[model samples]
Target: MDIAFFTDRRNDLGESPVWDARRGWLWWVDIRLNRILAADALGVVQREWTYSQPVGSIGLAMGGKVLVAAFADHFALIADDGHAQPIVAPDIGEGAIRFNDGKADRQGRFLSGTMQHGGQAEALAGVWRLERGGSATRLETGMKLANSICFSPCGHWLYLSDTLEGVIRRYAYDPETGALGPREAFFDCNTIGAAPDGATVDSEGRLWAALVTRQQIGCISPEGELLRTIDLPVPFPACPAFGGADMATLYVTTIADSGHKLKSDHPDAGRMLAITGLGARGIAEAIYHT
Candidate 1:
């Protein structure tokens, strides 16, 4: 696997890479900076936007004109001009929890998870589903450091994780009603000595998960088997998404080692990487509707 730099800037907590094939741009967030950025295929930042709150993750909306983002406190629609349009404010597990990693399902419903700063020892973290019309609903509870949110290509399954437990659970998803069935164990990162951070499913239904602390990306099959791992030089790869001219390149977001749970010094920790020769194609990210 050949990994190359995608951008010159370092992100404290870079995540949620989304590719817009129609526009030939890549979008992602720098959580610590509360910034969202869009870059060209060559990694030149063409446009940048900032927000008042930490941007946990972003889902494209209005054909990439607006971004559906999970701000630390609430969900909002952010425009190219940096104007934030308020959306439904769901309960953020009281004051201790703030919204984190989010993804839009095939049907365009946005789902986000709330997590405690340290962990879920407080037992207040939860997953939420937000509809296009500003209606939000609780999907799952009893979580900690939720991440790795992605759905099956057919929209019948959803994979989410509570990073503290190093496990990603699969649930039977209701695409029509935005309902989730009981969750069952899907993939465990314990085997790799890491925790699941973020993930995305490819067009072939294979799940590519960023295994934080392990310095690698793990690919799993639809049957929940760890197929293989792509090693990285950095210590904490926070998120992974497939994008590029052919949608075969894997773009990864990373966390700075200086800011990791077990902080250390690593020069390349916060930089983003574009990996090639993965031999996988990705589905276009589902944009948030309305």
Candidate 2:
């Protein structure tokens, strides 16, 4: 697939790339930049907001406000007016971990993951769930790098990717109770420099995972079969999303210099990517506000 160059001003660490269907725009964050940005379909910067703290992820909440995974302090409620309020702070004693890539499930619960900083072991990270006007609950614990948190089209299955162990585990989810069942190996990525980061589910229930170091996104079937692969223009593709009015456009985000820290050539490393003709089923996009 051919990708249209959006911008060459790469981000130091671009992540959690999502499409806000209600606003018809793409929203993403530069973790190192401490900034949240929105852009039009044509890759035009429509709006931007800088945060005093590092924002790991952003998703639509029950109200008009947005839910943010504040890296250091805790989860924040970001109003449309650009105001931020801490909803839940990390309880370090009870395994206080920094929030990472997260999204909203169909049942209106915020599904986010956490990573322990300061040289903590990989097993300390976890995936948490937050309901409206409720407390945060840990869904899965002992995760290496709890990233790539997403739900299937039917909302019956939840996918979590651990970049460190390069494993994508699936859990049977009860949407009504927001409960997760036994964990099973969904997909095992054991290739060198091909760890799974962020993921998205297509309308067909197919999983598309971003392999950061290998510079390609893996398209796997629900039965855990490798269907095909899409080559990316640059290495370190952070996340992927299907957007456009029909949800046919495949949008991807990459990390330019975070790991290898590319020095020369290909300045579009950290910028987002748009690819057409993917010919895959795309799930419906969600918004935080009703």
Model 1 C-alpha lDDT per residue in residues 20-54, reported as the tens digit of each score: 88678999998878889989999999878877778
Model 2, backbone clash pairs (residues 3+ apart or across chains), number: 3
Note the residue pairs that clash in candidate 1: none
Scored by lDDT, model 2 comes in at: 0.76
Clashing pairs in 2: 60-288, 61-288, 203-281
How close to the true structure is residue 139 of candidate 1, measured as C-alpha lDDT?
89
Q: In model 1, what is the error at residue 166, expressed in angstroms?
A: 0.8
Count of backbone collisions within predicted model 1: 0
lDDT to native, each model: 0.85, 0.76
Per-model TM-score, in order, reads 0.96, 0.91
- Candidate 2 lDDT over residue span 191-277, tens digit each: 434788889999999999998768899998999887888888787888888887778888887776553343325656677888888
User: Which candidate tops lDDT?
Assistant: 1
lDDT minimum window of 10 residues, candidate 1: 257-266
lDDT score at residue 86, model 1, on the 0-100 scale: 77
Cα lDDT over the full model 1: 0.85
**Model 1 off-target regions past 4 Å?**
118-120, 257-262
